[model samples]
Target: MKKPKQKKTKEIRTSLLRRLAFLDRATLDIDARTVELAFSSEQPVSRWWGEEI
Candidate 1:
């Protein structure tokens, strides 16, 4: 019996130096946690409860 041929796969990987280069290219000074807090506090839960009361 003949063995079946296996397919080859290509793997792509980013090096640590390349990742650091990307971080250095970013210019934004915004804090992710601060933005999350701002959005969460802006929701309508308080306003809805105020209208209900």
Candidate 2:
């Protein structure tokens, strides 16, 4: 008996270093906690909630 061939799918992966390289090093001044809060606080969706205000 012969076995059937299976198709392979391409996998996608992300690299943080590659992405960070595009941004300024100075922008990394924010602490990990601050970034976590900023992202989880809905600040990104509400302009008034962000520090820009």
Candidate 3:
């Protein structure tokens, strides 16, 4: 079976470097993290919560 083609980190970094005039090095990296989306009125949400205001 053929392997699925996914966007690589180098490709993304190179693309960003090319688009931004000031950005030259391809040292950019992406970090994916799971975030909590629950909201509470009585308690404050965590700092890492993406859905919290």
Candidate 4:
């Protein structure tokens, strides 16, 4: 069976925008030039990576 999709509200979007909306022009420029290199998560080890937890 298929489930119905959830609806979005303006308030939720406004909240996210509020977090990204900074007043400092220099900070905004810094963020614009930044690039993500790598990331990691502390999940349980699995045999797929030759690790056991």
Candidate 5:
């Protein structure tokens, strides 16, 4: 016999929503558009010349 699958509980969903809300509030204080990209090393170039590349 196969067992039944369980759904996400209310507590777990509430906690996840709360964390997302906190992250949203935190990011609101920062200027994302003015942020600069700082790469220490050079980016790699893919050798494959496929359509997905």
Candidate 6:
């Protein structure tokens, strides 16, 4: 019998886990813009949000 080929799965790599819910501006004592910047620049989570993860 022939062996089945393995499927390729995308993996995310991050030094930290940044939860968006916890990144809220009001909770973090920062403005919305600052929170946005934090979320946007975050490496791993950014990819997941952008669907590139």
Residue 1's lDDT within candidate 1 is 100
Clashes of each: 0, 0, 0, 0, 0, 0
Model 3 over residues 7-40: C-alpha lDDT tens digits?
A: 7665433343322234323444335433334333
Expressed as tens digits, the lDDT of each residue in 1-53 for candidate 1 is 99999999999785665212223324454665222211123334445348322
lDDT of 5: 0.42
TM, every model:
0.21, 0.20, 0.16, 0.21, 0.17, 0.21
For residues 1-53, what per-residue lDDT tens digits would candidate 2 score against the true structure? 89889999999785664212244455564656332112223233435566642
Q: What digit string (tens of lDDT, one per residue) describes model 6 on residues 1-53?
A: 99999999999775975455444455443444344434443344345358442
Candidate 1 vs candidate 4: the lDDT winner is 4
Candidate 2: segments with Cα more than 4 A from true spot: 1-3, 17-53
Whole-model lDDT for model 4 versus the true structure? 0.51
lDDT: which candidate is best?
6
For model 5, residues 1-53, the per-residue Cα lDDT tens digits are: 99899886665333433212123343343556443333342445555583331
Between prediction 2 and prediction 6, the one with superior TM-score is: 6
For model 4, residues 25-52, the per-residue Cα lDDT tens digits are 4444564775434334455565756875
Arrange candidates by lDDT, descending: 6, 4, 2, 3, 1, 5
Superposed model 3: Cα runs more than 4 Å off: 1-4, 7-40, 49-53
- Decoy 2 TM-score against native: 0.20
Q: How accurate locally is residue 35 in candidate 1, as Cα lDDT from 0 to 100?
A: 24
Clashing pairs in 1: none
Taken over the whole model, the C-alpha lDDT of each candidate is 0.43, 0.46, 0.44, 0.51, 0.42, 0.52
Model 2 C-alpha lDDT versus the unseen true structure: 0.46
